[model samples]
Target chain A: MAYFDYLPHLVLFTIGTLIGLEISYKWHSEPFVKKKIEPVPLILALIGGGLMIFYAPLGLLFIGFVIGMRPGYGIYESVIGILFALILWVTL
Target chain B: MYYPVNFNLIYILLEIITAFIFGGLLLGLHRKVMARIQGRPGPPIVQHLLHTFKFYIKELSIPNTSSMPLYVAIVLAMDAVWILALIVGPILGGSFLIIIMCYAVHKVAEHGIGLASGSPYTKLGSTRAVLSATAEMPLIAVPALVFFKTDTLLLDGIINYQIVNGSLFTQLPLVALAMFVLVLSKTPYSPFGIVWGKDIVSGYKTEHFGVIRGVMMMGEILAFFALLWCFITIFFGGIITAPLAYMVAMTGITVILAFICALTPMVAPYHAVMIQWIFAILAVVNVLLI
Candidate 1:
């Protein structure tokens, strides 16, 4: 039952991660027809965003990762993710 | 025991003077901090003031390619709208609705200036400005959330509610965070600096110089202070009692924002819009949860 309580946050984290991956892929592969997509940042965003939903402080480190990968993942988007996690922490 | 209407007018005049002085100082301080972060000695704290003074003495030249009347009118109008917005903002305890309207008017002025200038660079900047404004529309949720929590749309009423209860920052940390992010993005140097980023050669002000540019710059600084004041009043009103404390909080926010700006690379316009929508959705969800 406790696991069910965390399901919504987990789902949000998963969705956010997938969206981040898609956006990052599109950003790097733009203007070229067959450029290979980089999956490292995508994987990191997924793992870090999931960790963030369960542990708020980890989101701060995730923010640093997002900032470091400029033009791929937006700092503001990471901020929004962290804020959503914080909201879930307070409410659910 | 109430004074005459003229006394109120006098107070308003004094308030405007204080706002301008401090707004210029804050802009100078922001430049100084940002430069220091980049490992360079920055300009003096009054550099913005000195620049404005120089603009006053410089010769004015309306671009031959520009629509002269529209260009001049929009610049003046932008300054006027910002002045009114600052007056109605939390600094003056006016209605929040009026403040929002003033900001919308300011955007119109921004668009008008860009279109009237007739430069390709300014046009591109204007397009990005429109995109940014669309993305920033979500910021209206800040006041809406406040109204929902306090049952009033007036700045004074919101502050009073916070005093009766505790700080909104403690009770609604998510909303507070969302609002802070919104404010930071709108600040001069954050990633949203796309409107004035190097690609556009100072963006919409590309064709503007001399006195007209000075007026726009003044308006920008004033708008910054008004937004910062509104943020403090809405979130930290319960804890900040004195004017000095308000100044300190504003400086802290500015310094922190400078650090963020110095560290983060500017995001593209599409990414900026996406980020704002994500933030807006999170804020709306948080409000519903509340």
Candidate 2:
């Protein structure tokens, strides 16, 4: 079967990640006001990245990067991002 | 043979409910065991469940320095990962690879919470958590070796192989030893628990309070159950055929772990990492030679 067959799985994963990020951005942002980089546009980028997972292993790496670059970036956060990327690359 | 994806939503729901309820009971039991080891009267065995409910009724407070979104996301994500791991890894006979992936995602939750908190203590905890993850990576070889022996990646397949050929632990004692070491580090109160030790005011959880803290606590209970379930399934044999055996083994291991934790002094993060690395190397050599 082609990797695209797993598109539903990828969509679910992307949706889960976006929901998680949007919740974080909405409730946790300082002043709780409108931000320049709202989470909706970012969700589109995440969907694009998730679709890319079918083309090459680098897709998960991109998704991980986007996740790490979200607000509240830190050293351990980046480390985990890389770890998740590597895991998805190897497993999926 | 791939089964049709029926996706019984009710089964999944029931499984999750049972896991959390039993998981909370196990956590409370662990606390009581630890208290007895320290010569103190412990709270009731249902203390953890009560505490979690108390947090639900309490006001939610977000620390000013914290990233609220990430904080909440980490807790919820951690709980989700554990639930999936338990259901898929052991219950539904999923691949060992998926189990490992779930574990990796769990580490992400841990790292995110510590980093999002913006507390120095949590930062230190996050750094140590990273170090621990690095050290724990080699233990993945345990499953790899199991795959080599069983010629299958599914937990059910491994259990069947044991039923036919003999226990994996007996055949591969060194891998069992390595897994024991990994389990020890994962257990609370161990020297490896510096991330949550008193020295750091509960480490990554220092900034979390009220309902959020409760969610984290629930995640922890579920995580512990997942680990213990994995251990019993992979090392001792399948819990399906031997439920009582698994329970006895779980209780025995918990008490022994608590005793070791009470007796041992907390080790520095560097020291803990070094020790795990040494064990990992030994496991590698064992896998290569045997």
Candidate 3:
């Protein structure tokens, strides 16, 4: 039941991303480049990230936060994230 | 063609109307804020409606430099996408991510139109618009993370979470703050108001006037309400328990936030960067703590 809750959101996110990508490509492409087109990578990134959120369900928020913080990962970031991860891991 | 009786077309139409009205209200508030900052009495709220309504019917004069069909197409697309976002909200029962996607779509559409114009000012505006949008991308992601942690991505779910947990501010205080900043920046509020700020030749609106401008104005209002709706839904909770009360509370908060926009000193781009850094740090800590 809990997993089912996210299924709809995941589907909608994917569809939305695709629509956005198609619109972007349609608007951005010039005449000469019309014949040669490929899948939009930015849209793909969002779709993949969204899918990860759907299946695993847990740790993604923290993971996304961590990934977002990137190479400058600070003490506060590590400590707070680990602590919360432990809390959810133990509780949920 | 019926899955359930959950969908109400009339209600959805009303929601779209409300979004536009709210947008017009923001324009009024914006004028008053600017007036106070500059030490003068600006026009009334109805000023925007009156001006735009008059402009809406006026003849549109296209410069010889203009590409009429492309220009009109872009304007229509921007308007349609914004209104579509409003309509889609209730139809989808206000799916949280879809709301965000609606916003992203609107932004992208605006960028396309701005870039297509080929005017130097419009080009500058489009660049600023894209840069500001780029800055917001990550900030916006923080809320979605909060949604994931709470295990509720629907507007109704987030609202219920607040009603159940007693105020979202208590749990994800950091995220709540970040979202407030996101709202101001994404909406291009003062200080972070680079897109259509006073000093920037109205950014993308530099060349725009008459009905095209009117349609863009309409789109702006609809877009504003959409962002506000998402902000209220995620952080404050959605229509939980008493829908009417929640709506009123959301309106009050939005008004207060608007006032805050009026009063705060416009921060420079570097300042916006520093503020975003602070917000990013807080979001990082928040993710771990949750």
lDDT of 3 by residue, B156-179 (tens): 666677777776766777887787
Measured over the true interface residues after superposition, the C-alpha RMSD of each candidate is 21.4, 16.7, 17.6
Off by over 4 Å in 3: A1-92, B1-9, B33-39, B186-189, B238-243
- Sort every candidate by TM-score, greatest first: 1, 2, 3
User: Can you write out model 1's per-residue Cα lDDT over A1-92, one digit (the tens) per residue?
Assistant: 11122233323433343354345556666542432334565445445656666663455345435433323235345555456556666776
State in Å the error of residue B15, model 3: 2.6
* Candidate 1 lDDT for residue B254: 86
What is the TM-score of each candidate's chain B when compared with the real chain B?
Answer: 0.94, 0.92, 0.85
Model 3 chain B is weakest, by summed lDDT over 10 consecutive residues, at: B238-247
Q: On residues B1-290, what C-alpha lDDT tens digit does candidate 1 reach at each position? A: 12233436656656665666677767777877888788765655456766876787788888788987888999988888878877676335779888778777877777788889899989988888888888878866777877888899888877788899988888777777777777777677688777777878878878888998888878877788787887888889888756667777988998988888888888999998888778877878888887
TM-score of 3: 0.67
Ranking by lDDT: 1, 2, 3
- Greater TM-score among 1 and 3 belongs to 1
Per-prediction TM-score to the true structure, in the order listed? 0.73, 0.71, 0.67
Each model's DockQ score: 0.01, 0.01, 0.01
Candidate 2 stretches greater than 4 Å from native: A1-92, B1-7, B238-240
Q: In order, what lDDT does every prediction score? A: 0.71, 0.68, 0.59
TM-score of 2: 0.71
